[model samples]
Target: MGEEMPLSRIAAAVGTPVYVYSQAALVERAAAYVQAAQQTAARCLVCFAVKANGNPALLRLLGEQGLGADLTSGGELFLAQFAGIPPHRLLFSGVGKTSAEIQQALQAGIRALHVESWAEMERIAGIAQTLQMAAPVAVRLNPDVAADTHPAIHTGGRQHKFGVNAQAARQMLLAAADHPWLSPVGLAAHIGSQIRELAPFRQATAALLRLAADLEAVGCRLQYLDVGGGLGLDSISQAAPRPAEWVAAVGEPVAQAGYELVLEPGRSLVGDAGILLTRVEYVKEEGGKWFVVVDAGMNDFLRPALYGGEHPIWPVALRSGRQRESRADHTWRVEVVGPVCESGDTLARDYELPPVAAGDLLAVMQAGAYGYAMSSNYNGRLRPPEVLISGAAYQIIRQRQTMTHLLG
Candidate 1:
């Protein structure tokens, strides 16, 4: 595979600032997920959350692995469909879903809509009724569980605007009883993202099981229980917990409670399986510190700026004579940044990178998930192209964002 078409060759052709994903790695993650949950539950469905990386190719591969989709917006729903995801395998979820979005989901007859609040449920019920269709829905419960990660991704807090509070979920379910246009398919909740510990997920699933019991006691035939995915992969490995563990922690709980399981995993699936390739533009020294400015910025990958995310940075080439075989001694720590002008626009605050001159290639590890999806045209800079690598070749999935493309 390395001899056929190494990543360095693709970066050389496309020019630096290219993102690529490995299909083999992604499939490995999917298989692990299936192996984990399939043991206890036959009615389980692993739904890949679309908001993390909306790339169609990635979705198609995940879908091919028998994974469904968890969508938050009309665009994501449309993207899911465009990627060949059947409406029956797609679940729409989000707070602040506009009536227009609800109408779209209703028309598609999606698998389920995880309604966030009582108000949204009433609206969905009305929309479904108007369309003369029964909207299969689930009430997202904010169990107030924390993922022990960054606060930005936290969604299960009572004060958070993500899901329906526990006290109100019961009442809302009762109110929803009369709305024949909607069916209580199950319950859903997302704790947060980039979580390292499994305890939070275990704890969160316990609460969801309890809520399912409460609903069942009230004569609600809850069919599904979605314990939202917040699984964290190693920052360096970009790989996460084994699928079996997640299934054991989540899928088993729903199975024990006699309900179907839906897992909406995002970053853990693609984050580590891909990386960003950029080129060094220039080098600068300030205040006795070295800086390696590259062509990539927060616009290309926002995780660093948004969550202080870290990605291993390495140079494409190393100087000769550094070593007889490997340029192991050429590596040095520097602040790898971009030309975005903001000090916060830096990509790696401090990184041990190979000695690189202008135009040398650098690979930013674990960047497949949120890398290009969160990119912007700030500083009038065009976003880079995206490539997908199989065994020994690369295909340009998305072209570099041209000035005309950005302007128009």
Candidate 2:
């Protein structure tokens, strides 16, 4: 993580079950995306998907690196603004947006609202009319492309309740073009998250470009083509396409078509940049199974329970006279469980780890993206703090939640 302060030292100071992010990693990833997009498209916007890790500090850091935000809710919209990202650099995207949220977005003057449904488009139009403002809108086209990822996260398939189908999307955009208060400005599609292959993205891009061309033939010009981001993290697979490759695959045709590119990357930018630190609470064997219980629970990191996420866990410090290579030979097959009172609270199942005592510190790798963002207070557990590491210095970006926070 490029921090001078040891992980054990930070864990000792902040207590266990804390998130630590590397500023250098965040900046490097953002730069990769931005540079790739810029090289591929003369005009582009790399909007960090705020739903991944909405820490104001992280948002501000990405914004400083010339990244905008792709927000889902009014709260995220507010967070983007609070982080000082200009409205022109912000894009609102989601399904099931409330009327109040629509009005809030319209009032905030974001670059465009990635409209998901016809009803949503109509709703935005009505609100914009009442406000006497022409709402900049983008139809979120469901290309019906099947991404090779978890079904739970797939959004672009026909069965998913995400964007409108291509035919319906075309009709909606055409209708919005003539509407009094709706300014159809872009076409967007987000197939799914954690997509490892480029074929799905290429397929989605083709579908979107064909629609854009059809619209253009009818004198309906679009400003941008938003192939919503799902570039998988390297932790998922090292063979996943790099930022440059991803941008070239999707952005080349769109750039040739003379449309600005907008990418909404979430996990790839921050996933590898942070980790969750926890302390081993107990190590026991029962019923021919070894369970290493840690202080962090599913409430602190829910990806394992929700998505069956397999994050590599490593000991922060080796015991005396233990060598890294030899320790693996002495490792035991174990299931890392948390303090939470649920069988689903297991973080890693049938994983191997070296010998660890009750007080040994463990680090959950590749947790920067969804780990803390999806956390909950479900077992009455307070959320852990988040720390940012820059060079040799570190700062607490978010304080640990207290009992009062839970009660509130």
Candidate 3:
């Protein structure tokens, strides 16, 4: 089946403003990386970024297939563990890790913690000392390689409050030997998200390799090189490199160094696997523009309003021949907006779409990664349900948020 089971059938059964995920697509996308890594000479660990889509059922499904979880907070760690990811299989990465969170991770024996600041490194060391445990740590390098993406998401630049600069990282690595509680085992850097080119990745890889070489020269033997994940998928019409291409680009250099490679992929593995199903509530024409108001607002799907993100939208029933609508050549340039009061709640502006009515269902494509994961109850609107579809069958992994739950 193609994208599978059709969004029309899903909307009919589950209602609008819902999220539908394809189980086959998710597994296939994840397995592509595993396959690519296996083909590489480098020993690799595939850690699914839990922040991307931390649905318990989804995480549990991925964990059952041997994918480890890459977490940013203690809550993500709990979700990953609840989903069956063992402590040893988790990689904790975040800028501000509380002492309590550090203690929790140390007690759980997580694989490695990507230490961002020297202060954070010290904090972890102190916590580990208190617990009488030696914590595995990796100093994240800033790299300063600017990826060609939205500036808000860029993480590796000097001004960004992400990893430490090269000099600071070098100092941290050298100082790690003095702290008996901290075992410096790796170096990590994440450039940004929604990146489409390979140059930035290659540049980041080379930078990390140089730092790794320098650290080794200074008597710091690193075990793994984590070239953090920002590998982009085709969100708009831009073509993205396949998982194999990405794996080859990043894995070859580290493979040559014989260091265990770790990739924390969030979007590329899940973005295209899901769709946001919404219903057109009204179609208005004013000021020489058509506005197609939808039931799902910024509270339900915020990517379009936040990142200026573009996702493909299609009529569900029209494509499936279930509704009496003509697939005419005529189209309307309409603004696909949500029912939120904020003017910024618009999903797409001046976009062309087939004529839609109040009852028509629209499927917002490439929504699996950040759609539901970033949803909220803003404006007191209840969050929609999530259905995982496998072939022709579908199961509601999450129920639509009820008014009772929202009120209470």
Compare the candidates by TM-score and give the number of the best one: 2
Measured on C-alpha atoms, candidate 1 has an lDDT of 0.81
Per-residue lDDT tens digits for candidate 2, residues 1-408, read: 766778988987899899999999999999999999999999999999999999999999999999999999999999999999999999999888999999999889899999998888889989998999999999999999988787888889999888898899899989989998999999999999888899999999999999999999999999999999899876533457887899899999999999999999999889999999999998888898989999999999998898787788988975566344523667878899999999999989998888887888999998999988998898899999999999888999999998899768
TM-score, prediction 3: 0.95
The candidate 3 region of ten consecutive residues with least summed lDDT is 318-327
Candidate 1 colliding pairs: 36-244, 316-361
Q: Pick the candidate with the highest lDDT.
A: 2
Error of 2 at 62 (Å): 0.5
lDDT tens per residue, model 1, 170-223: 777766666778777878888888887788788888888888788778887787
The candidate with the higher lDDT, 2 or 3, is: 2
TM-score of each: 0.94, 0.97, 0.95
Model 1 earns a TM-score of 0.94
Rank by TM-score (best first): 2, 3, 1
Q: In lDDT terms, how accurate is model 2?
A: 0.91
Which portions of model 3 miss their true places by more than 4 Å?
A: 1-4, 319-329
lDDT of 3 by residue, 1-408 (tens): 245586777778888899989998888887888888878854788899988899999998888767888899999998998898888779999999999899889998899999999889889988998999999998898899878888877888888999998899988988886678988889998898889999999999999999999888978889989888888887656898887898899989998998888888898888888989999888888898889999999999998888888888887764333342443546878899998889999988888897778888888888998889999999999988999989878899999998897877
